[model samples]
Target: MPKEKRPRIKNEDQYEALRDQGYSKEKSARIANTPDQVASKKGGKAPAYEEWTVKELYEKAREIGLSGISKLRKKELIERLRNH
Candidate 1:
């Protein structure tokens, strides 16, 4: 049997729309109608530490003074940001 293809989400508006509808990032990406959409929702190759609005993550990163924050993945960024 052929594998089923997953849809991708493109653009911030679409991503926001899914999010607004109460879809988590992972779920939204899975159901995105296109590959581009999924990529866009993932925040691209660039790290999206800045995209986070959580006060703890932001404040933690600020406290640590970690440079090149954009390169860190979500988990690493969260940890370092939180520890800092």
Candidate 2:
């Protein structure tokens, strides 16, 4: 038989582990494909999403390239940011 083809996963072990932990395939793949340097880096000093104004939240969503966010309210923006 021909060799089985597999996706180009940067971290196959991490992908398998994430899949076993019930993470969605896309989510698992995205996380597993992240570069080691980026993965180990810490987040910025931004405050909690809850404390951000609606405009700030909208701007943040745009900054992160999140789609369909113009219609989302403050609470929805918070949820989207947290889940993102």
Candidate 3:
């Protein structure tokens, strides 16, 4: 018989490994399929959250789908983003 084939999943090896390590299917797929493998990589050139302006933080929170952030103070926004 021909060798079994996976259905062309991007980063299939990583996905399988994540599954072996007990990640949920959806979470595994998201991490594996992220174009740059950001889950396993870190410390890019972006400034720390504390250095960002309140407006910038709010926008980032909005982009990340964080709720109750519209009226949050800068420190609160930072904490919320970190907690999420």
Candidate 4:
């Protein structure tokens, strides 16, 4: 026999119907909350790490005796600074 297809649910009411019929909570949540609808209101931006100025990075590098400060990228500098 051919398999029965599940209906697409669009909103909270439809989700509640599915839940009442014994669908898993995970599945019900998925149907109710799409990625675009559930995306963070912070506009999907990651938090910026505390950035050190070039001079500050160099000073920190020197303070910690890091030998490769001049060749390091900003991220690398931040990592090295953190480790120190």
lDDT of 2: 0.86
The best candidate in terms of lDDT: 2
Ranking by lDDT: 2, 3, 4, 1
RMSD, each candidate, Å?
A: 13.0, 3.5, 6.3, 15.8
lDDT digits (tens) for residues 1-84 of candidate 2: 985576788888999999899886778889999998988999879888888889999988889778998888799889987776
Tens digit of lDDT per residue, candidate 4, span 16-77? 88789887665676757665546444544633335447777778788868796898887888
Compare candidates 3 and 4 on TM-score and give the better one: 3
Q: Write the per-residue lDDT of candidate 3 for residues 1-84, one digit (tens) a residue.
A: 995664455898999998899876766877788888565687789899999999999999999888888889999999988766
- Which ten contiguous residues of candidate 3 have the minimum total lDDT? 3-12
lDDT of 3 at 80: 89
TM-score of each: 0.26, 0.60, 0.53, 0.37
Q: TM-score of predicted model 4?
A: 0.37
lDDT string, candidate 1, 5-75, tens digits: 54445555776688799876765665454665455674447455666665656565767566777666667
For candidate 1, the TM-score is 0.26
Query: Any residue pairs clashing in model 1, and if so which?
Result: 7-32, 8-34, 8-35, 9-37, 9-38, 10-37
Give the CA lDDT, 0 to 100, for residue 66 in model 1. Answer: 68
lDDT of 3 at 49: 96
lDDT of each: 0.62, 0.86, 0.83, 0.68
Q: Which ranges of candidate 2 are over 4 A from the true structure?
A: 1-8, 17-27, 33-44
